[model samples]
Target: MSNDRSKPWFAPKRYGYGAGLPITWQGWALTVGYVLIFIGVINFSEQDKPGSNFMSVVGMSVFVVATIAYILICAAKTKGGWRWRWGGKP
Candidate 1:
């Protein structure tokens, strides 16, 4: 015989072993931002001309700004953003 039981409303959902924090939209944003910033910085450093790499520098700056902005926004908007996992929650 098979038995099925409905969980109580207040009971926490059972996650599989080693289940980690769920990913949120802000996590995706931060990841993309960091990747862009890293690639931009590396590309900018590799350019040899006096002004040839200016765009890359600008790109990197934009990415840094975007990352900071998104982080702040996520802090205000989400409970599962990176900061929450880092220090925002117990």
Candidate 2:
């Protein structure tokens, strides 16, 4: 699939068993959106008031759901099917 770059949004890691930096705008946008949502959740975690605490149940729930969605999308978009790469032996 090295030469088939038609629909790949993320590239597989060279030495690890996951995705590397995004190779497309869609992947970058997804990553950035995920990070921004996480930060937003932390910054606005207080349900009653701002700057109170980080134990908001709603925030945690949203974070968990978003994280799961992000993981699923990443796994689907990443090239090589998230293969296990022991090293650059190939």
Number of the top candidate by TM-score?
A: 2
Worst 10 residues of 2 by lDDT: 46-55
Off by over 4 Å in 1: 1-22, 48-53, 80-89
- Candidate 2 residue lDDT tens string, 1-90: 465545878988888687888989999999999999999888767444666544677788889999999888888888776888977742
| Candidate 1 residue pairs in clash (backbone atoms < 3 Å) | none
lDDT of each: 0.48, 0.82
Query: What are the models' TM-scores?
Result: 0.39, 0.79
RMSD of 1: 11.1
What tens-digit string does per-residue lDDT give for candidate 1 at 1-90? Answer: 532222111211133221132245445655566677678777766674675867666766776786687545444433322221232222
